[model samples]
Target: MPSTPDTPSFHALIPCAGTGSRAGTAQAKQYQMLLGQAMVMHTLQALARVPQLSSGWVIVSPGDSFEWPTVNWPDHFRREACGGATRAASVFNGLGVMLQAGVPAHDWVLVHDAARCLITPEAVSQLIEACRDDAVGGLLAVPLPDTLKVQTSTTQSAPSPSGPRVDATVPREDKWLAQTPQMFRLGALHAALAHASATAFAGITDESSAIERLGQSPRLVPGSAHNLKVTYPADLAFAELVLKGRT
Candidate 1:
């Protein structure tokens, strides 16, 4: 079905410019091998199945030479070398490319993390449906199910040999762990990000933060525990186990 002004098309903007220093890999974490293929391949494959995404862009840094495989790559997705130092900048640059490519500013852009290889098609589709007609757009998130804690100021500044100590246990009644496919309109998101870029993108952790600075609250749709971002080295093993179990 073709998109109209009443129903704008959906596009994916994946910021793949991060160095992944936290993942402790020789290469970028997204390019690291997982289940015999690059971790991002799994992420891209999941997005490709959604069917609603009219186009997708993988924003990589200039001079990035990841050697992407040719066979079976999604035709709707393309790689662009306009990534920036931070995730916020990368997405902002990618949005500019989308605009230059003639994509309508009213079209929706689902900005997802490339390291979150465990994201499933159903989850992406769920987010799209939930935010399709939303006034402010939304993101996939899960309610905090465990006890929340705030560490002592001393411990936070300087940890002791005995490990950090919890200062207080906060209520988790309304807390939710934010996750991705943070969906927003192309023009709205671009404007929100442009405002943050003036301050070097401070306090702009995710796409939602940029939107929040504009006094707009994003809706949080239910997400799965399995849709974890592959951050640490140990997480790779855990993600592998989960992926293998699914197979």
Candidate 2:
């Protein structure tokens, strides 16, 4: 968890380099419009608005030459061109730059995704206060309300003329959907990512997974359901509505 001002300082990092293939647009989902501005611009702007944020950096996808003409880019951000095959790689690379640029190991590092355009100042403050203890890192996550299914395959002939009966229904338990703004101690996170990289688990989606590998469970901070990642087509519509309220 990250300590407060009286305890320790912190910095923020946003990984905008991801190519969101699930959104199925020519441009990455982060660059897609939410209202009039780029989706990523909202996410970065929200971070910039947070008074607690000491500094931030963005990692852009290689050769993505498109630049937003109207958005107010943060002065503290530095762009990195090289990103790894996985999300963990991109984060680790950014952390390296931050570490070298005078960010302390004990200072908190908040990692948020670019596609999460719905993130707001209030939500960011929630995450910051929730991460006030350094032993366990924290993230903005919402509890899962729907039942989950685990699939299994069985050998069978071609489908019969009659419809087949449905199998057992899954039960909903204590499942939570993880969101970003995942805050952690700089040294702990760096070590966790390094260990995961050595073990060849490059496909981890978020920072919590890497920390879990080190045997420490991260603390969960409640987040708004409205803070959705702009991935698929429908998300654009929802984001538009959310942004309209802001306008």
Clash count for each candidate, listed in order shown? 0, 3
Error of 1 at 247 (Å): 3.3
Model 1 over residues 1-247: C-alpha lDDT tens digits? 6667697999999999998988899999999998888989988988998988888899999989899998768999999999999999999999999999998988999999999989998899999999899999999999999999987787347866797788899999999999998999999999999999999999999999999999999999999998999999998888888878877
Q: Per-residue lDDT tens digits of candidate 2, residues 120-233?
A: 888888888887764778899998877776433234444545655444567667678999889998878888898888866565679999898888999989998998878888
Against the hidden reference, what TM-scores do the models get? 0.96, 0.88
Q: Which pairs of residues clash in candidate 2, taking residues 3 or more apart in a chain or in different chains?
A: 1-133, 1-134, 1-136
Q: Give me the displacement of residue 52 in model 2, in angstroms.
A: 0.6
In candidate 1, list every pair of residues with a backbone clash: none
Off by over 4 Å in 1: 155-159
